[model samples]
Target chain A: MSLPTLLEVVNLKKTFVRRSGSFLKPKKTDVYAVNNVSFSIEKGEILGIIGESGCGKTTTVRMIMRLMNESNGKILFNGQNLCGLSDEKTTKVRKDMQMIFQDPYDTLNPGMRIVDILMEPLHAHKPNMTKEEKYQKVKETTEAIELIPAEDFLNRFPHQLSGGQRQRIAIARAVILEPSFIAADEPTSMLDVSVRAGILNLLLDLREKMGLTMLFITHDLSTASYMCDRIAVMYQGSIVEIGETQKIIDFPTHPYTKALVSVVKDLNSFIENRETMILDGEVDSTKKTLGCAFVSRCPHQEAVCHNVVPSLEQIDKVQSVACHCFGSSKMGISERSGALV
Target chain B: MGKTVLSVENLSTFYKTDKGISRAVENVSFTVEEGEILGLIGESGCGKSTVAQSILRLIEYPGKVVKGKVFLHEKELISASEADLYDIRWSEISVIPQSAMNALNPVHRIGEQIMEAILIHEHVSKKEALDRTKVLLELVGIDRERWKSYPHEFSGGMKQRVAIAMALACYPKMIISDESTTGLDVLTQSQVIALLKDLQRKMNLSIILISHDLPMVTSISDKIAIMYAGKLVEWASTDDILHDARHPYSRALLDATPDLINRDKKIVSIPGTVPNLVNIKSCCRFHTRCPFAFERCKVEEPELKEVKPGHFAACFLEEENHELTYTS
Candidate 1:
């Protein structure tokens, strides 16, 4: 429906070699950060990936960017398999796809001034461009991120800037290449709460102004709901739910989604009266799964849920949920436990 | 509520700088009922930590609680001696700092460190302390065997749970978790919040949760208070504060937050940063940043007055009109 589906990821997988706690040395057991994950983004659409930490969200983005090789799968960017591309081709492809990391403190170079740091990406991508051209591009990008007056901040190092200003430099760097797609990984998590909204608004404004298709990664559902058009809720390495923002927020079908929605303390009196569904324990990233990854914490989880991994099925016009009991009302409100609803 | 466990009245703390003294807290008052969780929501440098540190007299030199009172039950803490404060710091009121890993001693075994606190406060034998420590570890969902492990052996979430367990060891009536789960991942934060709620119910304890995270705090706390530049701008029940916040600062803060459940029509950030708190004048702390700042705000600091049944707001608009016009 949109601009010929610019990027498509078909069944991507990645594994990290983690060391187990023993004298046997670091064994090669896969972390399974991403497994058989498939999704596509239109030319100028912002596709959001929502997940807890260790949920393959980062790995998936890294794989698409070709920062790390996918264990197996096809990533077609502009009808070219990113996995099949030669080192030279990949380098060229990397020019158009860039990532903005979560920690601006760690991402931005402490030694370099703001101008030089933003200029790094341009120097690398467009080596043919003159120094003046690159410097002008850096100025424009800085101005776009509202690091204006960019002239005043051009010579300041990362340490000299505030948390919000440092992040703006990082964003400027990522966008200086004028990448078609961006993977911003929790960009505002490290910034102060007062300054976080400024960065987010910048991203949204830049998306329209610069024609960017961003895959925003964050754990805060509030931010995701506000920023994203279509939300993909990922648990462990799988997309458990995918739908339009309003439907998923108002009438979530998956138990995990419901639990997450229930706990989203509302600013309305109605939320005060609504019961909360408190999920116990942590999201188990270490579990080897043949069935549902959310079964451990899902209150409505049945024997069948433990036996098979449910696929995403259309619940309505705009929402699709991956859960064994999504079709029924049995798992709605009756299955919750002790709470001040 | 079982009983009133912690009562703070007109607590004023000032940070003395080379320039001059900046009043960080002014006549802030709040009470935490037993088995209650009072969430203090604010941006950074809002003087929330100062309030927490003042309760334990943890505020160091150059920073002092100039006036006002703090009471743990009936014990007056404003003028308490250093030795008395030390005795009550952990035994009566303990704090879980922002960084769980940094709060703990890195060199010692975690179990041994916790046992030290138990031994110091309870006057128990080493063996009894060890046993009590194990019980506490199990209570916090950590295996008792983890007692032998070092701090580095555990993950960030595990370290947080251990820190919480150590705080529970002395049976403190009030626990102040200063951004306790801020550094952790969202999943870990939720689990920790659930565990905190469980422990509060079981122990019938009072908690003062200080965090920059507004939405998360609203879900967990019994009531909410918004602080700005060392002043309590608003304080109300979690329901009323979130639903009908009267203070302009509170409204802007709520607008600033990215709603997890429902996104706002437009992303509206609170314009500008908090004023630098050094040699400040008699004007309202939020006047520099407030969208509705008028002549009255710049000249006179608005007093926090009762707006609704339990809602308290500090703004000249509310003071003059007796109601607030908050645009969603």
Candidate 2:
């Protein structure tokens, strides 16, 4: 039996109209920053959205957080449509959803003390709570995030603490309210490798303790595989592949996912006959395409991929891939299915 | 390995601060041979970049290379005159900085910037420099005609490639790429590393790739040097470092790093932060975070010694016959 769904994003789309050229002749082109992104987070599950820059992973999260209004589609949180909600209702819903930004240096205010930083969310959300209660909650959250001897850190400023501590403070702030869903966007990428593992483990610990559902966003496949139960590979504003972490890494169906999985350098990869696919050209998000988004850099691009956009299709019990070749015999889908069996 | 291209001996750089002197790079010794790629792996503030800057003699006031010698092709660089250093700067050794966006001038054309390096170092005509710039651009997988475009016209990966082109403009014998592929995406980073590897093979150039990325470094570098708290903890061939890392810090780093292939393996982060370098004691720098630290590690500093053939590790545990096993 499966856990209850906490957050479900359905066919969400976000487009930014770019205005270029002279004042007299402005070229207004529709740049689809995010197109038809759909995913859900089960209760107490962590789903990672993995992609490179300009791949719409951030925009998708921003849209889900209601930071940016979506151009189309529905976001059903707890069976309630978040779109077209009033400001007050949206603010109420935001208490259950909290986001952890990418950069810890810019996220936390420099002048604020650790106590003030952690208490800001409570002040905003729980206005009726007593000042003593707020301070007690701050100490408790600080201790929960493993900032031991909480008194030593609560009085200090963000600058006095290290990069890893500042990040822990940031996490304390995010989870201070004990939200059900947390969106962490590359939370550990800014940290060093040694400190990064600590942060990842802390997030896992928080999820276990609070039973919090999480949307983990990162570009590194290794990190995503480690932290996430399910992985979604995004390319130019679309989820090309989404599946269980092991299945996605072991038998990646999409060409982009295959390329992404191939490029990841690990210790064991040195001894293996690694067939690395060095894809040319970067993601061009400005251009609107009727065909597949990854066709420009994909290795297995067929003639039909240029004109027909392939929808996400269920390839197995837990794997879903958006590729035209998956259904047809052009790219050995049967061979992949045979291996899967 | 071919002939020695660059050799750094007992190099120590310290930053003068209000508290005390911060030893950034301490008694570091390494040699880069011709056509060999050396991977310098370390955490932030661990003196990886300090070593690169000290080799180039770019350390300014307040931060000085107080001791040790840097030699390029048997010519001393630490004691070289300003004019001699200026002549050898890009012509003999060049640098691809971490941030390619800021390394390049926004107003100038990419081709003009690359040609500037060539024209300043070599007695070449403007037309010859332009031709050479075009060739360099094409060599790094950028279109020759795009040289006329400004920096903003290119993407992040293209800008990094342009930086690589500028580094190769003078035909320098050695290039120091200090986290050049940091901000780029995975595929783009792989492409950039592949380009550098290809250029190294074709031109017989030596490269010192300084990054915290262990896997990427191990995949490309002939030798790997692991640094911890301004000290060279371990230095060995890529295979040896991968299979037989002796230093506790190196083993901890490899364990800390998440791997895609080994999904079942648990990533254990080293507890505690890196020690402050200011007025540091003569002890193992990684003792605070080392899992196997003992009384000997807290008092005595372990020197980098050859534990095996072509493998060097700085740790007292190697002498104690502590059988270390790394399960990848």
Candidate 3:
């Protein structure tokens, strides 16, 4: 039997209306930061949202975390719609949902001690606990994150710890409340190559130990492949493809996903002759296109791609792609429009 | 092999802080031949940037190049006069620093920034410099018409290309790119690296590419230098370092990086953090993290020596020649 869905995002969208021109005649244009994004995470499974900067991967998660209000859609957490929830009810729900930011240096409070920093979450969520009980929980959580000799670390500040250690403390604080769901946003990108593996491993171990569901967001495809069981490829605020990690890496159906996978620099690929699909232009999120978002940079673009947006269609049992080349009657449309371009 | 354009010998740079001296770079040495790209790689705070700044004599107060000699075309740079160094800086050696894309002045046009470098070093008319700036922009694959655009008008990758164009404005023989592509996305980074390689081939220019990214450095560089805690642990050809690395730290670093082609490979992170460098003990700085470290590593410092011809490694395990077991 399949695991029950823990967090589901349906028809989520975020649009930012920009104002320009003179004070007398201000021009307004809508920028679709996130356009009709939908995905669901299975219990105890890790889902990764992979995309470059300004692709709305972070924005989607931010809206889920209630850090930013979504323009439209439904966020169902444990079968409850989070969008219509009261502020007090949302606070209670936030106890089960935690976020780990990218930069450990800035996320942590430099002025506070490690004990106080970790205790902040407990204080908010469990206000009735005694000081001794809170202190004991803090020590246990500190040691749980592998910061051994908890006494030594509990008294220190964030600045005293290394980048890896600081990140561990951040993780400890997030998991202290026993959050069933966590969203890690490029957690290891700011770290060194050697330390990155440790954090990734720790997260993996934590997921197994606590039965936690994770939303791993990253710009690096390799990291996504390593940490995630299922991957979602985002382009211009939309998931162009979603599939199993190995399937996405080996057989990417969408052109944007293919381009992303081709550019990953690996050790073996360095010496071998590999075919690289180099896209022409950067991601233009400002331009509101009526057709497909990737039509401008895609090499296999046809006349149909410029007129109609392709909806996500299942190509295989485990994979789904949003591209005209992989839609219904895929070959027929491509063959007919092949002569025009 | 071409003529040696830059050589650094016994280079040691230190920062004098209130809590003793911090050995930022210790006895690091390497040579760059004409048109050759040497990849200097290490973790953050490992002194890769310090080595670059020392080579360029850009280290300021509190940080001093305590010992060493830097030779640019057989001319000693350590003791060179200020006037001579000024004339040699951009004209002979230029730098594309980390976050160079953001280094572009927001108010000025991209064309004016490229021409400013040329105008300062050489006595040329504004019109002539502008013409050369447009040509340089074209060389870096930017449209000549977009030269007049402000920094905000260009994308991140385009701004980096403009930075490269500015670095090439004076036709420097050697360039130092210190983590210049760190902030760019994977596709844009590959494109920038490809552009750098294309420019290196076309101009026959020597480059010192410094970054912590191993795969990217190995993909483009001819030689690789692996630094750890302000010390050069291994230095060899890209092939030798990739296939036959002797130092435990270098081998462990290779294993630590996540491999894209081989998804099944397990990433092995080193056990400990980089040791403190301030008034450090005379021993292997990587001993805390190196799995093969023995008693000798704690008591005595290993000098970077030639284990094989043209390959240098600072590990005692090279002498023992143990059977190879760890494989990625």
Candidate 4:
């Protein structure tokens, strides 16, 4: 039998209460942000959750971390049902599952020094540690992230540091207890374009050194391929495609995935145009429509596309795709599931 | 052939502070050919924005144009009086700055704002200016009927288009877009870029597009200049710069950008942050982070030399005389 999964999600869903219409009666509208989403993370595996800003990538991670309660479905972490946990147990679980947020400047507290910011996680979960022990641990963790010369940085505040430094502190804080899993949500977007590569390499190095499992969230497919072993492409709160990173990139099955894969500007190619399948329209976070969210902009859309929501099917031996038309994989060595029954 | 619309020579801008003068741009010289799209590219603090502002004489005091000359249609702009500068500002050269969301007046209708700009630069009657304003809106792909709508009613991309239309009210010969598509997503970016390209071709307008996106710049611009710590490190045709970039920094930038063709290839981002531009350094600005740094790079800064036909780079490794500088 296969080894047990570290994180297993089943039929997960989230709906928010909206300020209802006129004096007839106030009604609660369901947003369906994360609608019937289900996935799992294997032991020490970097599973990439790729999607646009409003595709519910963040919400899925938030639900897994127990930051927000799921409207429905089960969330199992480390073979334990996290959704059914008491408030106290959930708090304990948070110590083991940390997240590295997008904006480095906004995440760290401006009022606190680097030392205090790094020590906050430890003080919160393990309050029994002595003050001297806390200081030593902070030094060790900061050094582990290659932040360099711990004493010089300890006295400096977050504002005094650069974007790269602040992010290092964010990483150091997250791994202080050495969390089993990290949910890095667009960690390098706010940084300078040139400095981004080093950050990615650091993450790569740390993963190998610590054997840390990560749930990498990013809109960039190339970055996902670089960092993750497997990836799940999210679209309008549902995973449209999931497979091995190389298999997915080489042979993307879903229309959305193909569009994303095609849009990237490669320095390696000399061809004038590589089928520019530009995805139309801005990603509106407030969309509460039924059926497929991308239907309004999808090019191959038929009349039925507007009426019926597509479901994920086993498209090939290794990959799963959620689309109505699963044709042959012209992209590379793979085959798409045939037309719907 | 389109006429040479704008020319800038030995342009140096500095930000004066208590610590020292931050030499943002040093001895930068480039000419924008008429109807040609030139991209000024670099990471943050590279002085790309400063170069744009200096050319426009929009660099407010404390951050002054310490050296160099700028010319509009070959007419000197460096020593041009404030009044003369005003005449050239929108009537000849226009700029689409980043903060259009807050730059436009909230109380005023979009049509009135365009008309006001027209009235200030050119002597036109109220009705005449209003008609022209609507046409200008239509030219930028916005509907004439929506001219009466407020800026808030429009989306981010539409607001930017309105800003572009407003800048073009006087039909300026040159336009500078400072990171206009910086924050927008890929789809919106390409659309805006396409619109700008269309406008450039139709109006024969000389456009200076400044941004940090290498692929986007290389895809659109006829020529590009890579800047670092306010120093221009590389200049070449778009084809040469992106495909066969000789400069270390340019290659690093290309390497850092995610490879769309080869998804398997990892992006090894350039190590180290951009050096702080507190005071001007004699050595090459990018040497601290440049992987190909040598002893000479650390001691003396190299001038931008012609390495290939129609290309220039401030690198010590490339041959000094390659006979390709004047193709620009």
Judging by DockQ against the true structure, name the best candidate. Answer: 2
Model 2, which residues run further than 4 Å from truth? A127-129, A265-279, A334-341, B320-328
TM-score of each: 0.86, 0.95, 0.94, 0.88
DockQ of each: 0.44, 0.56, 0.55, 0.41
Better of 2 and 4 by TM-score: 2
iRMS for model 4? 3.9
lDDT per residue for candidate 3 within A1-341, as digits (tens), equals 19999999999999999998899999998899999999999999999999889999999999999988999999999999999778999999999999999999999999999999999999999999999999999999989888899999999999999999999999998999999999999999889989899999999999999999999999988888889999999989999999999878777778777767756734233222222344558677888888999987776778889999899988878889898876445434453232211
Output DockQ, candidate 3. 0.55
Candidate 2 overall Cα lDDT vs. reference?
Answer: 0.89
Give, for candidate 4 chain B, the lowest lDDT window spanning 10 residues: B319-328
lDDT of candidate 1 over A1-341, digit per residue (tens) = 54678789888887776777668665556677887788778888888888877778888898888888888999998888899678888989988888899988888878898888887777777889998988888888888888678899999889988878888888888888888888899999887777888999999988998899889998878788888888888888888998887766776667666666656644332233323343445555666777888877766667888889888777766777888876556654444222221
| Consecutive 10-residue window with the lowest summed lDDT within model 3 chain B | B319-328
All candidates' lDDT scores? 0.81, 0.89, 0.88, 0.81
lDDT of 2 by residue, A1-341 (tens): 18989999999999999899999998998898899999888898899999988889999999899998999999999999999999899999999999999999999999999999999999999999999999999999999999999999999988899888999999999999999999999999999999999999999999999999999999999999999999999988899999999988888888777767766733233123223332466667787777988887776678989999999998888999999977567457564542421
Q: After superposition, how far is residue B22 of candidate 3 from its true place, in Å?
A: 1.5
Give the top-scoring candidate (TM-score).
2
Q: Report each candidate's C-alpha RMSD, comma-separated, in the order given.
A: 4.2, 2.7, 3.4, 4.8
